[model samples]
Target: MSTHDTRNTRGRGATHMENGSITQHENHTRMREMTQRNQDMERMKEEVIRHVQSRLNEVLERALTDSLQSLSTHTQTHTDKTESTNNRHKLEEGKVFIARCSLLDELFEISHIRTIYHMFIAALFLFIMSTLAVDYIDQGRLVLDFDLFYYAFGQLGTVVWAWTLMLSYTLLGPYHVLRVWGEQALRSRWRTCVCALTLCAAQTSMLGIFPVCVVLHYQLPPASRFIIILEQIRLVMKSYSFIRETVPAVLKNTTQKDKSQRYPSLSSYLYFLFCPTLIYREVYPRNPSIRWKYVGMNFLRILASLFYLYFILVRLCIPVFRNNSHQLFSSRSLILMLFHAAFPGMLILMLGFYAFLHCWLNAFAEMLRFADRMFYKDWWNSTSFANYYRTWNIVVHDWLYYYGYRDFLLLSGYKLRSMATLCVFAVSAFVHEYAFTMGFGFFYPVMFCTFAGIGVVFNFAMNDSRKSPVWNIIMWVCLFIGQGIHVCLYCLEWYAQIHCPRTGTSFWELVTPRSWTCNYQ
Candidate 1:
């Protein structure tokens, strides 16, 4: 019995030992699986961290680049504002003035702008050589005769007399009348009205009736006519400027104490006449000294530009138009002529811009020490017609903006915005058409249609939101086509006028374009 009991105890102990070994093995496997999972979780966390860090670096880099560009642009703009402020802050002993800015002091710091000037100079040289080459090939040798220019500008005596008369009236009559009546404290509405009427009548006679009479009666050539008409507009604009500025102040200070204060000094008025500005001020910012070399260079460029225009017109226009008045008018021929004229048209456009905006204005500005040189902006790089027109001729634009468009807006109490825009376009078109008609001695509605009609269409179509390069290309293409059409059509009309002389002295016959009936005749 003792031996059987002992065996049972041994069996139970073996079973318990087996159970213990199995439990040990299960715990070790569980530990191994948990260790592997922990390692995988750590690896995933490390990868996520790396990815986030890289993204952060990229965003920071882009932000830094953008910040730098903005800073540079702002700095440049600030520099411009600073120079402009410097220009108008002259404290003459007794003279008061408005604060303003100049463009030259800001733009010249950029090296690329100088490069652009050099490029234009190079282009001038190229233009000269190109003209010489064509002349040499056609005429067996170069025959440089500037007789066309000489003849067109031959009778300057008449223009000088007209200018002298206009200048004397502007310098003497209006300035004195404004001061005399303004100082009297008359408070007479009828007197003011009479003075205003007199001034208006005088201005009209000088700018309107007198010029039309001279052009029609004397029958001046195109170039000489341009001188008289442009001067007429210039004088009118200057006179209006003087009145616009001084009259307000005079009326504002209607009190007895303010009456004794002087109108703008005579020297200021004279300076305003010669200065390259259409806006009038009591005192203008002046340079300390004149740069004679700069003046001479601009004048030289003006002469070169004249020759350039001569070359372009002679070589590119005369040959094509000399025989066009005799040819049959067809869509195909018209299209061909337009395409051919495009080259010279562009040249003419560029030359005119350079000659007037840069050379002529800058020369006068330099001589007058007119430091506010914001005459034009960078218009060539414009992507929209709206921007282009604003930048093209800032002086004229300012006049129109301040006097015409703004006044109309004010008069209408800011309503009729579209109508105001249309009015601006109409006035501009009228002036342009008038100038062209008087200069060329014909009424070819080509200038009017392109400006008032097509120009308005484009102004609305290619608006300011179009900032892409594609839009810029389209704008340039349209300019090229428009200019080509203008040149081709004008050349055709000019030739027809010469070839088809008027048989009857009727007003309609004189005003009518000869090109239309010349082909049919």
Candidate 2:
């Protein structure tokens, strides 16, 4: 039992020992793998954290750069604006200082420049005086003979004389005179001058051919039509009635110079309506530069005469005879034509005449007479466009400024200064129409009112300086064309209303076919 049992037990014991050793080795291998995996996971987590911190740093740097760049750009823009504003201020100050310096040095600086200036001024004075004196002599009917041909020839001679004097004074007279007298600023000033020249040139050319064209185109009549004479008389009577009614209304509103002052004449009323009140009140601060400007204006007087002569011959006398007519040199026909062109033309002509006379007298007084009273009380004393508007024909401007401009603004309850300007201009057009009705005995107020109303609206609506140049030119052209159309329409209406019996025969009806035309007699 001992030998057999011992042998079997030893074998079983060996087997059991081997099985236990194998199990122990397998367990050790599993523990090693699990520990290694955990260590690798911890290393991976650390690497991921480091990578995230690096990315955040990069983003932070980018954000800082963008914020700094934006701030710098803003700072630069502000600095530039400040610098530009400073420069503008400096320029304005410099101009004012220089002007003051010039005035201070005037007495000491009176050298050859001064002498030449004075001499040229004297020559201009003489030229203007001579032209005006000649005009007066002609107008006063001093010449004994009054034949039509002679009258025409004399007028032509007067025009030639005026032209000659103007050219001679401008070319041969002092050099300073040209500089002082002829220099003009503002785009509108030049445009107006060009338009005036165009008018004269065109009209003169047309007029020169009129007599020949008339004679060739139609047979002469023994007697002029009496119907036109009666029409004109009726028109005048109607116009007189309108004016009589209007004048009293105007008088009631106008403040008098004194309680004793009588009611104004038609001419005076015209002056009031057209002229600016601001001219009577000082607009600009007084300075030597301003004073010298008047002297220069005096020199320009001769040139103004040339303009006047051009208007009288080309605008008035010539246009009337452009087409062929049955009546040859008939006084009644001439009068009729004159009446047709009278209102607007007279308003324009009177303003020019007043300016011309003032300048002429101012020049003469400054050069030959050296009268202070003339400078103070004379017409050219208000030669500035603003002054001329206000003082010389103050009633017109006053009416515009007060009733037209101020009243409109107040009535409309507009607080903006810009709108106020529009209100005034619109009012001006209205009053101008009213005046026109008094002269024409028709409701031309609508046409003229619209024309002027547009101008007022435009002057206000398009107030930006950048847009002004083109707009101003357009306005001027429109005004010229509108007025021309108005004149033509009036003429056509007068003809149709008198001759045509049809309900749609009135000019307004012909154009728009209104019910009013059907009811008119």
Candidate 3:
């Protein structure tokens, strides 16, 4: 009985031990699974944190780059605007005086250029000989008659009187007004307006209306009319420059009541009136001494150029155009005439530039011991019409740029540069047309169209970006064609006006171009 009980107890004890081992193994496996699940969750949490950090970094970098780019662009725009404003201010201040010689004067110092000038003199002699020969052949005798010159410059007294009166007014009127206004203790806005109106009215009546009235009332010839009109324009410009340059100083001094401030002297004003430059200044660059010989030589050259122009007109222009009114108009004939006139027109243009801008201005400069002789630049080398206009007639161009274009920009608050450019072109065109109308006694708008229409188109189209030599050639070709058209059309109109009688005594009839309907009987 004891053996059986012992065996049963041992079996039960063994089974209990095996059950305890299985429970221990199951607990170890469960603990290992739980540890692995915790490690996996920690790895996923770390990966998500890294991904979020990377996205935030990308967003910050993009925002920073955009903000920097925006700042840079704004800075550049502000810098450009400031530079533009400064340039405009400098222009308004007045041209800086530099001691320099005229372009042609420097060129004439070269042996080769002097030879070319000698060639012109030789050509003038040849022209004289040809004229003598023609006179001998036609009238069976040699006779020198400058009937054209005499007729062209007929009204000398009227021109002198008008010019004297204009000069007197320009010298005294602006100076007196500025002096009186500047002496005032306090100038009100209404007072300033009154002064301005008074100046404007006086200028309009004396300088503006007087010259035109003289020309029309006396029936001035072409050359006389040109003299009066050109002088009128010059005096007007001079007066305006004087006022423009001094008024600011006057206002400033008067406002501050500066005892040290002094008005421009009478002697300086007198000198300015006679100076070659249109710009007025209290002082000008002067030469150490005047060379009367140089002045004489320049005057002689100007006389020679005048004779050269006369010969060109008689030999090349008159023969072709004098009888043109008798012929019926045709497109082919017009084309041929235009082509034929191109060379002569170009010659005249060069002659005019050389004579007035170079010879005459230089002569006056030498006489006055004026040092600055940069009357013109190398316009012939210009590749664009814009450059050409800037280089050619630098005197007038400076006036126009400072007064017209820059002032317009200031008035517009720098918002419309393109519009300012358009306004400048319009004003220039109007002035040119007015001068031509007054000079020629006709209302031809050819110059106006050329300046406002084709000139504007070319200015934009043939911009400074064009650097190719082909563009230069194209510019020259356009100039040739334009000059040809100007010559041909003006000549035709002049002759047609003579040949064609007016059907009515009306303003329209007078203003209308007679070349449109003149058919010779």
Candidate 4:
């Protein structure tokens, strides 16, 4: 073999050896990279699994805790209710009394709520300024004369006299009758019936008939009539409650042969008559001391409210409706009037509620040192009319629920809850209409139709099932429209009666709405 051929073969062999080593090193490097990737992937997977397990554990723990809390709350509530039921007498099973502050009183403690009150006061100042500006523009002078107030509150002496008589009758008549009846050793069914009849007759004459007759005969102004009629209703309810509460104990005592049971003290009866509560109790939750400052503040608020109402009427209400009766009645005008009246109507409604429910009642409650200041509840928060009715005026509602609704249920053997509710609504509507009719000296049934008809329907429609804020808005809208309708129609009717003279003096003519036929324009 040639020497050159041997050298070339050796070089080729070296080259092949180098290439194989290089290939082996590359393969080892690739294997390490793949192993590192696998380890990283495994670590990531472990982290994901741990995260999932931790989240699941937290969710389970939360669910379990919530379930335990709910169970504990339900058990505690049930225990309290059971204990209360077992301890309370059957007659007093329904009514429960607890000392609590009014919703506004609590809300007013919060700064934000108090700011809203300040806003209302500011708005009232604006109203006063507006009234002054208008008076200057129209009459070249700022008229501050409260002529409407004077007219509405006329015949103060008659109101005072009538109120005194009614109160005296309520204080003396019902208590004496109950005392005399309870003193009987043997309360025979006949005697009981006679006593009941006597009470019914006396209440009808003194509380019911007397106030109506006086208002009609004396030609009392609207405010005076309201005072007398409201007092009349209050005394009536007070008397009924006294008799109802005491008679049950009397019968029970007589049956058990327990002579220790005597009539409730006259002092308690008088206190009940003046207290803010309509439901009568032998003993009530009372405050340790009266806060004169608080009482004074409430009265000041009431006076402010009165001025607020006056401005609302003068600026927003009277200007629109005073001359509206002279215009031809059309649906478009009526609708425009309704919408226009809505703002003022809402203002009036709120003012009425604040003045009467919050201010007046709170003042009286403080003066009496009545511990339970829950004359009303969070009615503004109510999304349903039923809830509103229940919370709006708790004093009257409690009386109606216990005396009127519960009694009807008892009489019907609890088989007619729906019927009982209807009856209660009817009674409330009637009383409202009756009061307005007497106060206004007209037979307008606007309140009656709205209250009994639309009110009942809304009570069922906007039930507790409505929980959304949309429902709340809808409830407020309904209130606005209702108030607008009431204010517009009543105001129109009032002016109509003045502008349109009656052609016939017949009973139907007297009761008929003058706004329907009056075209003074």
Candidate 5:
């Protein structure tokens, strides 16, 4: 029984062992497959990393190349341009844009500005029609009387004579005296000073004393006297400019003159007297041809402006002033008169600026073939009183700056800019006041106060830095008010003279303003 049982147990154990061995083999095969799959995944990850890195490197290289190329192109362009500019400058080529025509000339080439010219013509026609209608309505018929103008401008021959006298002094005397002084000054410096002083005294007599005599002794009418006196002032200013400009050169070249140097030619002197410029250059750029058509047009503009002024005075000034003359004088009355005069005053200002500075100066310049025609800048567009003062009359400004201010600086050893400026202001104011006094035959200080007090205040207050349009409007308002004051006061005095004739020509009576005491009512 024991032998059978043992044999069965041994057989079962051997079968069980065989089954366990099969299970172990299957487990080993599955583990080996999983390890193989993990190794393959690792190899794929390495390949992906290498490929992405290579692509990034290519992008960086391309971006750097493009950036370099752009930088190179820009650098090369700038360098080429700079080199060309340098070469041109170094060569000092011909015709380097020395002179161009005025900015106004360019604008005139445009249609809009030309249209403005037509507008002016239209305005002139309107003025004519208005004057005719007004006169026809007022007097029940149109007389077309020009007698007032004729009477105002009566005796212009004395003006011509006074002008001739002033011109003779300027043309003939100054140069010779300068030459003699220059020759003598070569030996001694004090001699130069003495001779200069002596010349100054002689010039004062010729320019100042003689013209005053002509004005007083001849008893010139207001308009005729204005012509002479203004001419006198012009001559004095021009002569001073000439002497200041030329005397230094003469003195400097004295030794050079002894040793084959040249003196200023007579032709140059004559040209300087006639030329529009106050700062004289011996040889100025000239036009190729005289534009006679332009000259004729300018002259026509002058005549039109004169008629325009006449119409304004007759229609606006006479009506306003004549009606008001009978009113009792008071601050209220004067203020009302000023307000009424504003339009006519503005018209007069415009006519004065356009006629004298633009038309008259341009005509003379064209006829003389003077190339530099920058008589006035855009003064109407000025934003400040200082700017207006500077651009209002460039000719006069140049003279005063070169002669009065600059010369004063020199005489004062070049230290006082403010003092020099003040001196220039004083001279200008004095001359203006003198002209007014002589013309109106009264010593009213309106112009003097306006010029010295208000002008100075505005010059400092509304200075060059004021660039706003508001400031420009303010400047214009000030100009209108100032012009209004001038027209009202001067016209009052004019009527006052006719209404209140003085019994005696004593100093007090002649010098005092008749407008203050007149009872036209």
Candidate 6:
């Protein structure tokens, strides 16, 4: 029995040992599974970190390349701009150099031309002086008032005895000289003739109004109260003719057409016009006088003056006769009369009848044709002061340039030259003032003289006025205000005088007391 019990105990012990082995195997399998899961998680985390690092590297690389490209483009653009600026500067310098070379070339040419120019100018001056002397000798005193002559011509016989001699000289003379001296072809000669004739015809049309007025004045009834009104109407027509006929001719091509079959109608007209004026070699007359061009320009200005004078006379007479009441009684009436009746009426007279309104209507007809200088490739275009003076009154400016400035420069020093310029301007201003006074009275002339003196002073004081826009505006404003005040004072006096004529005031009191020679009855 003891052996059997011992065997059972051994069996139990074996079973317990097997159970312990089985439990140990199960615990070892669970630990192995947990370790496999932890290892898998760690491997996944490492892969994620590596992938994130690779993406970050790619992004950084792209950012670096983009930044570099932008910097490169900016640098190239800036460099290109800098190079362009430098090139522009070089080009400007080159232009300056070329201009200097051109100036030297012009100086050499002038030196050669001066000998002839001076002698011719001297002759012209002598001729003028002689003419003046002869007039003084005949009349016992020089007829200083040029307006009298202008008026006589404008109001007397402007048509038949039209002074279009200058147009004849300029258009005809140049080609004549060229033909005689240059031995130009027959075709070229004809072309020149056409140009000359056309120009002359056009100029005559513009300037011929004064002569027409003169003729009309004789034809029309005289010594009547309406005589002034008739003259004014004729003057308006004269202005219209000037603009229509003269401006176009002056602005159009003054050259005759070549033998080429182009422009048939124009060519035919030019040919017809030029044939009569040509002097076929009778030793072509040499007119060294620059006065011809001056005369043509003067024609334009003179016609304008006459037309304007006519306008003033018309204004003075129209309201009195038309309404049977003084138009200046009400401010509205005065403004309407000046704007509608006076200014616009004058404009219409100048434009409607004037042939050249086709082109020059936009231009300053009252001023000078100096604006042509911007397009004119000549000596006068190169200077500031010359340009200004020329712009003021082109015909007169030309006269001063040839007669006054050049002669003064030749005879005396710089001081005299300056003085001569001032003198010329002053003389011109005086003439203008005196002429204006005949129609509008004396205030304008005084103001004009004062401002002209200022202009002369300013020309010397400031050589470069491009940077002086502000100062220029200020100066102009001051001059305008001063002139305005002066004009206002005269207007007041005139207004007072007009009322006095109705109020029984003494005529001497209404007028300047200084000029009155009163003989008390």
The residue pairs in collision within model 4 are none
Task: List ranges where model 4 is wrong by over 4 Å.
Answer: 1-92, 185-190
Q: What is the TM-score of each candidate against the true structure?
A: 0.77, 0.30, 0.82, 0.82, 0.77, 0.30
lDDT of 5 at 155: 82
What lDDT does candidate 3 reach at residue 11?
100
Which residue pairs clash within candidate 3?
none
Clashing pairs in 1: 84-100, 84-101
For all candidates, what are the clash counts? 2, 12, 0, 0, 0, 20
lDDT of 4 by residue, 1-521 (tens): 79999999999999999999999999999999999999989978876786799799999999998986777686988867765565434534666667788889867755689999999999999999988998899899987989999999999999998899999999999898888788862447787778778988998999989999999999998999999988887888888888888888888988898858777999999999988988888888888999999999999999999999988888888878886767877797799999998988998999989999899999999999888888888888888888889999998999998898878867876557788889999999999998899999989999999989999999989888888888889999999999999999999888988888688889999988988888977
Query: For each candidate, what is the lDDT?
Result: 0.80, 0.42, 0.86, 0.87, 0.80, 0.42
Question: Which parts of model 2 are misplaced by more than 4 Å?
Answer: 1-399, 402-422, 467-472, 490-521
lDDT accuracy of residue 404 in candidate 4: 89
**Comparing 5 and 6 on lDDT, the stronger one:** 5
Candidate 5 residue-wise lDDT at 326? 72
Return whichever of 3 and 5 wins on lDDT: 3
Residue 409 error for model 4, in Å?
1.7
* For model 6, the run of ten residues with the poorest summed lDDT: 94-103
Pick the lDDT winner. 4
Question: Which regions of candidate 1 deviate over 4 angstroms?
Answer: 1-142, 255-260
Mind giving the per-residue lDDT tens digits that candidate 3 earns over 178-225? 787776624567767777788899999999899999999999998999
Cα miss at 342, model 6 (Å)?
18
